[model samples]
Each structure stands twice: as C-alpha cells, then as structure tokens.
Target: MLAKHSKNKKISDKAFITSGKAKLAISKYGKENVINATLGVLYNDLEEIYTFDIVDQEYRKLSSQDLYGYASSITGDENFKTSVKKIVLGENIESNFPNIYTDVISTPGGTGAIYNTFKNYIEYGDKVLLPNFMWSSYKLISGEAGGGYDCYSLFDSKNNFNLLSFEKKVLELSEIQKNLVIVINDPCQNPTGYTLTEDEWEKIMDILKRACKKTNIVLLNDIAYRDFDNKALEFKNIFKDIPENLLIIIAFSISKSFCSYGLRVGAQLALSSSHRVIEQFREASAYTCRGIWSNVSRAGMQMLSNIILNKNKYLELKIELDKSIKLLKRRSDIFINESKDIGLKILPYKSGFFITIPFKKGIDSKVSLELEKKNIFALVMEEGIRIAICSIPSHKFKGLASKIKEVLIEIE
Candidate 1:
C-alpha cells in the first residue's frame, strides 16, 4: 500500500519526452530536417552535447580512490566547498563577509540544493513564491517537500520585473506564514531568459527588508544559468549588509557551468548575519543529506575543485566556456532576429538557454503539438513554448521563428 503522501503522485517530464520524440524523428528524417529544442544543454555544431575538455582532462587525472571513495563528510569535501565559494562568490568567504556568517553544503546538483532548501525552510503545507513563468520543477520540488507554491507576475506591462506584484505577494505571504521562502531565478532566468536590472535588485532588497519585519524570510537565489551570462556577477554586490532575519541561499551548479550535467555536483551556499543561524543551517542540511542521498559524486566534486583551484586549468575552462556562450548567443540572435522579421511575439530575452514564445493563454499545448507535426520539438508550458536555444545549432535557427509563427496561426 502507498503512503498518503506517496499516493496520487504522477510525474511526467515533457521536456525529456519531447526530446525523445525529436530523437526518433531525427533518426527517421535526419538532423537537418528536424529541430529539437526541447532539452536545455549546450550542443556543438555537429549536434553533440558540448563539454569542456578541461573537465574531461581533470577527471581523467583523478586517482582510483578519488573516483570511488565517499566524501569525508555528508556535507562534502572541504576542498569542494572552498572551490565552490571561490568560483561562485569570487572571493575569500571570510574577508568578503566579515560580519555575515556563511556555510556551504554539497548536494547532488542544483536540483538537490533547491530541494534541500525547500525541505528545510518550507513548513508543511506552506507555499513558496515563484515567478509566473518558471522552470516547471520548482512546483514539483515544493510539492515533494509537502508544500504548495504561489507566483508573482514576472513582467509588468513594460516587460520589466514587476516589483509591485512581487512586493504584494511577499508582504501578503509574510503576514500569514511564520517563514516565507522566495525563489528568485536571476541573471538569465529559465523559460524567458530575462535578467533583473541593478535598479530592480535594489528595489527587491527593499521589499525583502519590509517583508522581514513581519516574518523571517529565506531567499533562494537559483543561479543555475549564471555562467552563461557574461555580466551576471556585476550584481553580486547586493548580497552585502543583509538583515539578520533574512537568509540567502544560492544554489550553485557544476552541471551547466562545467558541462558536467550527469556528474551531479552542486552546493548550497548560505549567508546570514547570525552565527547561530548559519550553524543551524549547516547541521540541519548535513543531516538531510545523510537521510537522503547521503553523499554526492566524489569524482565530480574533485574534478570541479581541481579545475577551479588551479589557475591554468581554470583559465582553459573559461576560454572553452566563452566559446560555448558565444555559440549560444549566435543561435539565439538568429532566432530573435528572425522572430522580429516575421512578427512573432517572444518574451523579452536577455541571455540564457531558453527563449519563450507566448501565445493565447491555454493554447500552449496545442501550439507545441502543431509544431511537433513539423518535426520541431519544444517544451510546452502554461505560459508558452520554450525554445531551448542551447540545444539547437546556430545554422538551424534560421526560419525557425517563421515556422513557429505558422504553427501559431494554424492553432489559432
């Protein structure tokens, strides 16, 4: 017999399923005939998943013990945590936040980091706040933690961050919930690829300060696509001088940045002005890790630490990653320009793996199904069709927007 929480659980990952269908079509019609933009992973010109050579080289250098041995602690290896902080925060953690205490705990991947945060911070039956258009897994993760979710309008009429809607939701939730957990996917958000401006971030911090007066808050900043945005770190300085009642948890992933998607290496970097709070976070998070996955990939963690700590290796990885980012940009540029030429309406995209094409509400599935008839596979969502620019090659992007427009017209 199934437990109460386990009953009635049905999960279907449309992205992977659509990707599978695209693969079948490619096998039948060839890659040139079908456009597979379902899965979000960087693909080379030859349509192969792109990975940094430096990662492979470093991984090969690890000893047998390094590859197979368990991590020293449930939290993860010391070197792994240090390297993650260096790469993500870009400074020595001690000096950078002398007054704010910090801690890092390794997780299976960015997914795990977010899951742990949800499980620990989100009270039973509580709801987390998310963007209206977001990665679909956030809702599933919250549900798994025995919590529900609400959303704030991601964009206003001006196609900018809707601070008014965001503040209203935060304050409203704070009034009811003892702890408010808010997830902000910034500097290249999923589905829409929109980034918040500096002014928006300042205003957001003000909102959090106001909300904190009513209830304790946990801000989960999911920067899974941070490495793709060349200017993402420009706004990192906003983390300083946070309130004691507020805790910021950054979900850092090695999967996207290092092109180690299957390696399952990620970490939770937590910041708080209170020492006791930081300690509690470390202990509770490590305990959760022991209960769930127990430990992450040792080889994956070692490879990342080796690459980030070594200057030459890190430089090489950066150069390779830059080329990948450029390729993604080229692909996205073609799609955006073609969409403009054909009068296809897409969301305001800055930089990221995905570009969302919004249509009439409740017709996203129909639109995507229509596109599937033409052998173009994309993830259907409540908001729109998400074109994974990272999966499609540069040359294949030509005329895609026009074809998608054709599908939209047919659906309507």
Candidate 2:
C-alpha cells in the first residue's frame, strides 16, 4: 500500500521517455546523424552543452567556507537577495516599480519558488489556473501542494494571447474558490514561446482588479526563461501599483542564467501594495524553506551575488548572456522562416528556448515514430511538437521545420 497522496502519482513524465527514445535512436544510428531536441538546456553547434565561463571561474575561486559553510540565513544571504533584485529590476531599479514593496527568499530553483507559493497560498482540493500550453511541472507542483490546476486557452484564432478566454477562466474559477492562483509563464513560455505585449499585461491586471473583488488573487509569474527576452527590464513596470488584495510572485532562477543548473540557486520575489503582506510572505516562505531543503547552495548564491555586485564581472556576465540570447533568437529565426516557407504554421513565438507547431492530437505517436526513424528526436506534446531551439544547432534548424511538416503530412 502507498501513502494516500502517493497512490495516484505518475511513474514518469512523457518527456523523459521521449528523451530516452532519442538517446536510443542516437545509439542505434549515430550522435551526429540524430537531431535530439528533447532537452531545454543550451548547446552549441557542435552539440556540446553550453555554460558561462565567468560562473565556472568564480566558483573555483571561492574559499572552503563559501563552498561548504551554511548560508548566512536560512532564507538566504542578505547581500545575495540584494543582488538578485538589482539583476532582476536592472540598474535603474527606482523606475521599475516605485510603489511596490519587495522581498526575496532564496529557493532551489524556479521550481522551488513556484512550489513554495503554491504550498502556502493554494487551499487543499482547490485549483490554480495556467495557460493551456505550459511546462508540465506546474501541474506536479500544484498537486504536491494539495491543489489541482485548470487552464485558459493560450492563443486565439489569430495566435495572440487569448485575453477573453483568460478572463473567462479567471471569473469562472473565482466563483468556485475564494483564493485563486493563476500561473502566467510568459516572455518565453515553455514548449510554446509566446510573450505578452505591454497592452496585454494591462488588460490582465484590469481583469485581476475585477476578479480580486470576489477572491484573493495569487498570481505566479514564471519567468524562468526571461533572460532570453529582448524586452529586458521594461516588463517589470507592469506590476507597479497593483491592487492590495492581489499578490505577485516572480519565479527567478539562476540556473539557466548562470549555467548553474546543478547548483540550484533561485529566489521568490514578492510584490504587493501593503508592506505587511510582504512581511507575511517572508515569514511563511522562510518556514517552508526550513521544512523543505533547509538552505540553498551557499557557493552558488555567493558566486551570483559577486558577479552582480562587482562592476567588471557584472559586465562580463551581461555580455555573455546577451550573446546566448542573440544566438537563441537567430536559431528561432531560421526555424520560423523555414517553417513559413514550408507552410508549417507555428504558435506565436516572440522569443524563447522552444517553439511549438500545432497538429491533430492523435498524430503525435506516428509523427514521433517517423521522426525517430529518420534519426530526428523532439518532444511530442498534446497540442503540438516542441523543438528545443536552444539545444538544436542553427545549421540543423534550417531544414527541421520542413521535415516535421513532411512527417505531419505523412501521418495525417
């Protein structure tokens, strides 16, 4: 017999099995011949994993105390918290959100930030709202926190953020639950790369204003892929002067940004109108930290803090990140343009690590089998096929979109 909550647990995610299939295909064929695009991690044209030189150098320079000693606080080092805000809000922090009081609590990764928010805010048996196309982890995190999740249609007929459907779902959910947690993965959403325009953000806040009248709003903004965004810190201004009843949590991750995915450095950024609400967030989050992972990586926190606090290292890191962002954009351009040439329609992909192409639901298995037979591997989801542009080489991207279209045609 299993624990009551553990009885219904999933054995493994489809992505993992799909990836295993890709690896097996590579073994059967050859690495150079296979297009393994199942992972979200960045890779170079040579099919090697990418990491920042600065992060590697700094980590090696840290003392044993910095590496092995416990952090200054269970929440995190105070200076590390300050550095995270500076990096997130940008050098001109005053202009980002003059009215909102902010607080930070370090976590394992963006996953920890989102899970902590759900564990504290989500009531048992209630539900959080997510985009219909999202990282599968949101559902897992919600379940672990004793809650369920629903979704709003992510795109309209024209392939823009579906505000009407979003508002409808929010109102419908509010009617049933007193507290509502809506997860918005934007700038670069998972699987589907869609970014909301400034006007769209305004409309969402406006909807929340009305919805907040009926229920307490806990809006979790997952910005794990935000470093690739071309909009930069300009998007931070959207949260300024939000309603007091609405709490905003920014899921910040150093994993992708610093290539420290194994180190697991991340933080939960809380924004609200009332200072008291932020303080409550700090207390409740720290308690969760104590109960869960205890404390995050000291060396990882120290390294990130140092890079941000020092002018030279900060510039160096920024330069490196900017290069990766540009590289990702270029790869996306190749796929988007080639897909258009082949008449293969893609979802609205503003910027991100992955791009999605919609197809009939029942054709995924056949399409995936065909792709693997041709030594091409990609994530097959319910809505579409996900191409990890970050992991795929630019040269390889040139013809991938067409091949996928060909597969779809064959299967259909």
Candidate 3:
C-alpha cells in the first residue's frame, strides 16, 4: 500500500535510542551512578548541556524580523555565506587560491550539507567512497539518494591512515564510475576522533589529482568538529592548487561551533578551480535546498553573522570554546592513558568528541548491551562501541576505561 521507495525502509538512529535509555537510567539511579556517553553534545561537569555565553548574548540581539523572516536568498543570507567562508577557510582559500571559484549554500545542519551534495552529484546506482570506520549516516544518505557506498580501510598495521588502501579504492572506484564522490570527515572526525595529518592530506591530493584525469571528483569534507581542533586551519593548506576537475565541499555546522544544536544551521561551501562547475554547483545546490527545505533558521544565521563579524564577540566565543577544548583534552588524557594501562584497545584518536573501542565484528551489539546492564551507555557500531568523550565529565573519566575493559573481557 506504500510507495516503492517508502516501503520496507527501516530507520532507527542508534545514538538517540541509546541516549534515551541512558536518560531513563539516570532517572532511576542518581546521575553519579550512571555514565551516559551516547550523544556527542558537550556537557559540563555538572551534567548540563553547555552553551557559549557569547552565542547567547548575540542571539538575544536578533530582531523579530531576523528571527521570523525568510533568508535573503536560497543560497543563504549574504553575510552568513561570507562569514562561513571566513571561519572555515580562513585566509587559506582567498590568499592562496585567488583563482578558485567558490559558493556557499545554507542547509539545516551538517547532515543537510552532506545530503545536498549526494543528491546533486551522485547518479543512480553510483557508490560513494568512505572510510571503513565512519558515521553510519553516510551509508544511509547514499542509499536514500538511490546510490550505495564502499569504504577504504581507515587504519593500517601501525594504526595510521591507510593511504595504500585509500589509493587502491580511489583508483578502483574512479575507473568504474563516471563521476566519483568521496567523503572525508577530518580534523576531529566523528566516532573515531582521527584527524588526517597534513602529510597524509598531501598524499591524498596526489591521488586525487591523478584520478581527476579519468573522472570528475567530488571531495566532501565534513568538518562538524573542526572548532575543537586547534590545528584545524593549519591542516587546510592542502586545499590549495586542487585540480580543476575535482570539486571540494566543506560542510560547516553551527551545532558544535556555536553550541546551537537545536537551531540546526549549517552550510555547504563548494570550491572548484573551474568557474563553470562552481556556478553550476551554486544553482543546483540552491534549487535542491528550495525543494527539500525552503530555508534554514534565519535567527541562527543572523546570530552567527553577528558574532563572527564583531571582533569582541568573536574573541569571547574563542575564549569560551578554548575552555571546552581543554576540558575535552583532559577527559581524553584520562581515558586514553587509563586504557593503555589496562591494555584496552581503542582506535587512533588525535582529537575529537568520540573514541571507539574496536571488537570482533559480530560481538559489538552484545558488548554494548552488557555494558548497558552496568549503566554505561555507548553506541554500538559494526566495528566497535563508540564512547562519547565529549559528553562524559572529566571526573567520571577516571576509572571508566577499566570498567568497560572488564565488561569487554567478560563478553569476549
């Protein structure tokens, strides 16, 4: 009785479901007894959702019209577009690659930016290239676009970026498909917290430059957690001198950066050496935005533009964000050092919100369920159990690794 595409579609977000269970546990037992490391949102030591004060002040300054009015353009407000490029690309794109053509389109969240790219670029039955350990939504998004996906091994024997596997897969897919789409979640990548080094990016560019000769390439960089990494802008030097056939999309999110998770504001900034391609992107992306979701939150866009453009407000926002970064570092140190001491294995995590503990392929669900019985909630993935270091308080991180290790031992 349902339409073909709508029928037999199973949709359940494990992170939200697990987080719900964690909340129920907290209600049953005191907060001190439960560890809810399911969601990626920042939580203070007092177990409250943390918000940036500067963001709050600026948001309160917005006029009624700014809050309720439609965006100035389908591509987003002009100021929002300019501010996004400034914060994300900084001076790298403008100073280094003055000739590159760039355009920005506003979307609901980072997920919207990603989905828009997939819908416009991916042809039917084409597969996207992704990392072996990645946000599960990438696969779902691709499927919804009438396409599928394949993954390159994310790590190697030394627990580093698997450049060899990446090269092989990139070449293989480019040869098979007329247009290639690849997603790289970098500079505090989700789940695994792995950031690609500049050298690794240089190597990736070499591969892309070579592949672009055979097929048009789309590189989607989901930088939802970039604000948490101090070296984020430094690593973007690789964005320079990209081949004309390769288009780069930087997905920017206000959820983590502005601490405006509920506002759902984000943008897709498309960069290309070809003016014609970027022009096409601007038109296509705006059309998709109008069809799917007419316009993003105007209040969110106004708030971001105001803060980013004002020097004092921008400085205050940075100061507050630095504190959260320090807290994240402390939590990461405790868990990582303790994990090493107890001989618990975790994926290579440079900097980010989540840390993953890999296990036998089919045993992750059982492991997560067993941990839930102990009131420790983490997300179960195909490769591991994802522990949200961003949500866990630094004090709670002290003996947490050992407890999880014990459960892992018992389950295995």
TM-score of decoy 3: 0.98
lDDT of 2 by residue, 230-336 (tens): 67436465776688889998899987888777899899988888899999999999999999999999999999988899999989988898999999989999889
Give the deviation of candidate 1 from the true structure as CA RMSD. Answer: 1.1
**Model 3 lDDT tens row, 219-328:** 99999999999877553578778788899998899999888999999999998989999999988998899999989999999999998988888889999999999988
Tens digit per residue, CA lDDT, model 1, 40-115: 7888888888988999999999999999999888899999999988887886667767688889999999999999
Worst 10 residues of 1 by lDDT: 232-241
TM-score of each: 0.98, 0.97, 0.98
lDDT of predicted model 3? 0.90
| Candidate with the larger TM-score of 1 and 2 | 1
Which runs of model 3 end up more than 4 angstroms from their true locations? none
Clashes in predicted model 1: 0
Worst 10 residues of 3 by lDDT: 89-98
Residue 322 of model 2, lDDT score: 91
